[model samples]
Target: MKRQFVTTENTLRFLEGFSALEKRGAEEACLMVVDGVPGLGKTSIIEWWAGQTGSVFLRAKKEWKPNWLLSELIEALGQVPRHGFEKRFKQATEILANKHEQFSMDRRPFAVVIDEIDHISNSEKMLETLRDLSDTLELPFIFVGMGKVRTRLTKFPQIASRVGQYVQFQDVSLDDVLAMAKNLCEVPIKRDLIEFLHRASRRKMREIKEGLSSIERFGAINPGKEIGLDEMAGKLLLNDRITGKPILVTADGFGGDNE
Candidate 1:
């Protein structure tokens, strides 16, 4: 499969949220929350932003503690882990502050993005640590997680209050599907077929990619046909369009499947 990253409308919204957060002064809020359903391309946007801004990016583990999180940040800053939690926390914040200063002088944005944060969202100490880091360093901290993450963070009022921006990713629209198909598909795919795949995948990014993979397979098998919904006859378009459903086996009994 061709490697591609399609910047959809949600991607633009995320960029705007971060841009707004970056423009804030030290007295203003620096923490941002991005939550949505699974497979909405939150992680992709996070990585893309991190790459563009040269920010530290980390993924929270289920067993992570405050010290582990601090150590990871330290490591990302090109430093070895310190012995104690306080030492690690201090070192990480100092490094981030220095980097933030440089980026400020260069008129660029600097941030630390944490992905898959649902696992650590319930830990009060972890949440407090993030808040402390953002406050002390005066650098933006972005948290990406599933839909309930916003509600889960509300359990910690202090942490929730520090959030300056909240972005909820919605399901991909037909236009988004078309853009992705145009960028990722090896062959030309009709607009209606793109919409069909979008609805078939339930507008989830992972499943939408799977649907594109199926289209690629069909194109390779039938080299001369223009890949479209009609051309995909006797082939699976998606695994299951809705919940508690069986696999969509084509009427002509093709072996291909989509998910």
Candidate 2:
């Protein structure tokens, strides 16, 4: 399979949300929330975007406290974390403020992304600290989680009111699956196979990639043939993560057990 990142409708929506957050009128309203079910590619896309934009990305820990978050932010900003929580907080804000100014001058979108934010979403202290930092610096903070962050944020009206954009990742469409196969697969795949994979994977990005890998391997053995549903029949296309069995393509459709 080719090493690539395929832009889908979800990615475009996320970019739109970020653009809206960047152009927000109120400084204090600088928060963005992105949520989706597992296997939808929320973390994968956010990590890719962070790398491209030079944004500081932190994965929230189950036991995260305000001080731990501050320390992580300080280190991510390329500075040594100070001993005391207050000192670390000050350091993080100063560095983030400076970086925000630099990004503004360069016309680049800058944000602090907290992935797995659900871990800390219930902690009022941690959320309050994040809210305080964003409010103080007028910088954007993006919270990425597995479908609950949006509802959880409502508990903190102060934080919820400050959210400038909310992006919910949805199941990939057949078009998105086709784009991924075209960009990431090593060999040509027919529309029939692509559509089958889309349905078999239930439109999940992670499962679609797994199915693509199966097609790529089959294509490699065939050498230059465009793989289709017929060619892929009786082949293992995806693994049933819940059942620990291979899902094989059959003449009529797919089944959890191998043909």
Candidate 3:
């Protein structure tokens, strides 16, 4: 693979927590709130975990109504292949339960991983829908998205307080960035390039990876001896697409970095 994921120890620890929740008794199943900036590898981690455990993965649309969203969930369940209103719901729930003719009391419960949950973070109807499915059928589920989920959960205290684990995923560090850059590009990145990238990316993984690739391409094509800050600036200045000027960034830290 292109090594998009950083796969740090923190991510592994969070996965361990997920596994513990899944293996717990039915009554003890829990929800999770994974808060992070966009493209911080949150979705990738969830997808990888789902793949590793043979669980189903579903992403919440940027905007969705309850019925449309429910249909999307049903579609993800692999039950849309069946026709009709009556058969669809029956088949959907059945497929979600791993197609077991009888719900196994001790069987590993199916994991329903929902991403972009914060889209419906304030919608009680949507929240209640998930809560009802989990409570009535006693299903195992996990939700991943933006914002402080605890605040959103206040709308539904029943669901909010039931969350057994909460984790905020973040970007890969600059130290990890250089190694990933070296590994992916098959070339050593100069310290200045790394420092410039660290400043530009603000420790955001996707931005760092993209910045590294841009620098590597300049190195390969421009006949440059080494990738450095000036070369990177010439080739890929962080310019606002709307304005034709180089972006000026200052880091007083996230507390108040606003220009």
Where in model 3 is the C-alpha error above 4 Å? Answer: 1-5, 23-26, 81-89, 99-110, 222-226, 230-234, 237-259
Clashing pairs in 3: none
The TM-score of candidate 2 is 0.95
lDDT of each: 0.81, 0.89, 0.64
Task: Kindly indicate the candidate among 2 and 3 with the higher lDDT.
Answer: 2
Q: Which numbered prediction scores highest in TM-score against the true structure?
A: 2
Q: State model 1's lDDT.
A: 0.81
lDDT of 3 at 218: 68
For each candidate, what TM-score against the reference? 0.91, 0.95, 0.75
Best by lDDT: 2
Local error of candidate 1 at residue 98 (angstroms): 1.2
Q: Residue 40 deviation, candidate 1, in Å?
A: 0.6
lDDT tens digits, residues 1-259, model 2? 8888889988998999999988889878999999988888988898999999999999999999898899989988899999998898889999999999999999998999999999999988999999999999999999999888888999999989999999999989989988888889889999878877888786788888999999999999999799997888998999865566777877665452221
lDDT of 2 at 46: 88
lDDT of 1 by residue, 1-259 (tens): 6787788989988988987776666444889999998888899878987988898899999999998898888988899988999888878878888999999999988889999999999999898899898888767899999989999988998888888889999887778888888888888776656766765677888778878888888888888767765677656665664553533424343332334
Identify the superior model by TM-score, candidate 1 or candidate 3.
1
